[model samples]
Target: MRQNAERCTAALSAAVSNYVDIFEHVEGQIIHAHQKDQERKRNCVMMPSKKLQTFLSLPKKQMKKSLSETSELEKELGNYTCALHARLSPNEHTAIKNSDYVKLSESIGTSVKQAKKIATTVKLIRNVQKQVKKPEINPSKEFTMAALF
Candidate 1:
């Protein structure tokens, strides 16, 4: 049983390494496709291509919301680090602030950095709104009539 456990661990390690390699290759392909789409005058919306679609379909699991939910369309692009490492105990929700957190520009490009910032800003705004309460006013006589003069 111990031998089998060791073998399973080794296999899992190899599998994870292989997956990282595949993800790296996919990232490169996504970058290339993005550049190509930029160069082309034609929009993907009019005629969707497989490369474009696959690149867009890549799971952005780290985001609190999807690209469509955010105000800025480009904010979805970023380096998607696995949440498995970042996630802590059940009580801990926010990721620990550390240099270990991979920046998108290091793996991807500058575009991703800007996008991530926008996404973060949007999230902050939403959080602030949630915490704040608006003052209620009576519609019948909230404003003074003397102010009109």
Candidate 2:
């Protein structure tokens, strides 16, 4: 009877120790993940203007080009508005007011631009997917995928 009790006590002690070890391992993983996340967040602050300028250091011609594209798009959009207004109705004394016509033209332009943006974003994602290198798995080494947990 004493031997049986001793064995039972030993088993119980081993089980408790295993549980404590697993709990500690999981706790350590959680702490590690949290610390890594906090470190990433700390490193993401915006750089100062001087530092940013030094980092960029773009050529003057390239900078001029970037600025010009903005004004050019604005002018092109204005031309679209002018063409739309001309086709739709006269400037003054029309059944539809000029403000309403301008608003309608602006909304149409915005929708067209949004559609283009969605298309461009999709294209970019597809391009990135194409560029990504997939690990080569030998067909002979392939096994049935594991069932969902």
RMSD of each: 18.0, 23.1
**Model 2 regions lying over 4 Å from their true place:** 1-4, 45-149
| Cα lDDT, all candidates | 0.41, 0.45
Q: What 10-residue stretch in candidate 2 is worst by lDDT? A: 89-98
lDDT score, residue 129, model 1?
Answer: 32
Candidate 1 residue spans exceeding 4 A from truth: 42-149
Q: Judged by lDDT against the true structure, how good is candidate 1? A: 0.41
lDDT of 1 at 76: 22
Per lDDT, the best of the predicted structures is 2
- TM-score of each candidate structure, all chains considered together: 0.26, 0.32
* Candidate 1 lDDT tens digits, 8-125: 9988999999999999999999999777645442321121234323434444432323444553432322212112222222211122122222343232233555535533433443
Q: Candidate 1 clashing pairs? A: none
- Model 2, 1-149: lDDT tens per residue? 99999989989999999999999999999999778655543442222235223322445444344435566533443343343333332322131332343443343333544434423333332333233224446665565343322
